[model samples]
Target: MVARRRHRLIQRRKMLGFSQEQLAHQIGVERSTVVRWESGEREPRPWQRPRLADVLEVSLEEVDELLAAQVNEEPEAERLDFAMRNPAAVDLVTVAHLAQRVQQLNAQYDAAPSASLLADAGHCHSQVTLLRGFAPNGRIRRELCVSTAESAILMGQLVWDASQRRDHAVSVQYFDQAISAAREIRDPILEAHAQLRKGFVALYGTKTPKEGLRLCNETAIVGRAGSNVLSGLGFLHVGEAYAMLGERHDCERALGAAEESFARIHNDDEALHMFSPTQFDRLAGSCYLFLGVNDKAEQILTRSARSLVRWKKSQSIVLSNLTLAYIRQGKLEEACGTLHEAIDLIAETRGGGGLNTAFTAGREMSPWRHEPWVQEISDRLFALMTT
Candidate 1:
């Protein structure tokens, strides 16, 4: 069953001005088939997806995302039903459902509002926590605890994001719980994720570079124990913390280590979800921006921006940083244009990271506040706040 609710297909259909019947006819399928596909009851056959993609004017990759969106919108009722029907058989099926649901929710993190998703995510976390308490002995219980760790980490993320990166204490509490749970299973990857998340709270939310750096180093150590790819990803954050500290030499070395790790990464690595193809460049761009090398930052961020379209919140952050790079370089018109684009994305997603970046960029433009375009941007931001 679908475990997340995303409306990519529905939005695409409306954008193309096609009704279910019309799309079905164009794709040579029954109207019911279109309804089923859109409603998450069924997926199109492999052979049929190409035609569907063509009709929807989406690429094969985008078609996959759209289909995944439809398939993951599973209802809470179904999970409760499973729990009720086979309290005795809840070992495998229930664990599988919860794992998939948590993963799906995490996948939507970049595009969905944390506030909109918090209740459902919290409910899932509670279910996992309850199951952990009464779960049967041995392997099943261990697996359930692992899932619980993941769910707890996700909860911490959602809570922090929903609070606009405030509520650091509560968020860190969840992360600590997640870390303890992972340690129970001796799962370094899970523990590393928790540490990295806690590092985020330190760096962004609390503005504690020392604590963030310490957590980042610890995360890298744990990741190195299990997977080189994950280690490299952790080092990227280490580099970020160093940049924030204005430690140029240390930042460069950390970034180089991250590159080496990236080079060693294979397709079979665990915790690959934490690594993004755009990660190094994106972080590198930010590092340069922090170091006041606006030209280099612009070069990197502009390139990464083009490749980050699918991740709306990530793209918004890149665009905001790119705007800052332009503003620092006195490229006033370019900065104004890019800020508008970032604002558009922030309006749609309300992503905390993006929202934070937007405001930071605006604050940096205070010297230009009297410019007509700058005034216009300020008005837009005010509207965004009131809205």
Candidate 2:
């Protein structure tokens, strides 16, 4: 009998695109029991009627009506009454029913606007409430079945939020959570993503490129087969990290790896949408420029600046890097112009943290730190940093 009920429940849930864990939360049952029921190993007792009906969004009469309509049978009403009379059972049913309702409402709002354009704002609010009601360290500790892809997307949004607020701690915490979730799902692609984001946090938020390189290397390893774009990005990050460490050989090798990876990429993959071959060339050029290879750097940086005008989101970092290249070539006037454009883009988007970008640009400009032209840009940037 338990097997029949579980099968029916599973069918109903699949029609709704809900996972077993989601249904369990809705019906106030252990996920294990939900699994067992679907597997035909156990049955819900008569006492679980109210909660089950509530979760299914049907009335007791409606349930009876459906059952009778289908098979000309009736449940033993006396047994249900006996089970319903038990306070513990009744409380369990009530809680289960409430949880189901909350889950349903959350789904509805998730599908349609509840007064906001961002569906996650509503979800975030509801999740906070649901999280508060769960037992501390209980089976329902967190929302189960949140996939690695979903976690990465949410973490990216949180990172954007942290940058806007200048909350490095929050950004790091979110990245950590994203990494943990990715690992749990055993998705190498997402694991690489989490590591890359964490590396960004270290490089921009904390000025710790050494730590950032460690994270980037890990990303490159996991991302090699998962997505070439991310793998190439990881190599680029390692190159920057090595540049900061003044390890010219390591920097050159990392940059060469990035270039090769970029060259090998096919046009069919969607993961490359965030970056392009031009961006990769620019990244390589920027590293060369920083290592004092002025002519090679100019060739790469100029191409990057030209391509970046079309990729607005990347302009802040690209322009900043190009400004360094200009400085290295002794074109102080052009470098200042590029700096102004970068500052404007950073201010307009306010996406990547401005202070973080400025600090990196400042560090790259350290070779000419004493030069009046370099100091002039640094002074303006430093003033912005304090404000």
**Could you tell me every candidate's TM-score relative to the true structure?**
0.78, 0.56
RMSD of every candidate to native, in Å, equals 10.3, 12.9
lDDT: worst 10-residue window of model 2: 139-148
lDDT of 1 by residue, 103-197 (tens): 77887778888788899889888887777777777655776788789889988988887887888999999999999989988999899999999
lDDT of each: 0.83, 0.60
Q: Which stretches of candidate 2 lie over 4 Å from their true place?
A: 1-166, 267-270, 353-355, 358-387
Write candidate 2's Cα lDDT for 1-387 as tens digits: 222343334434553446889778887888997787666566466777677677766677644532332232223233224334542232222223333433454334312222232354335433333333332432222222133233334444444533443556765665676567556556666667778888877766677888999999988888896778788889998998887777889998998898787777775443555556576776677677667787787778777777766555366667777776776667767877888777766554443543355456677678778978778878777665554
Candidate 2: residue 292 Cα off by (Å): 3.1
TM-score between candidate 2 and the true structure:
0.56
Cα shift from native, residue 183, model 1 (Å): 0.8
* Residue 19, model 1, lDDT: 76
Give the CA lDDT, 0 to 100, for residue 61 in model 1: 88
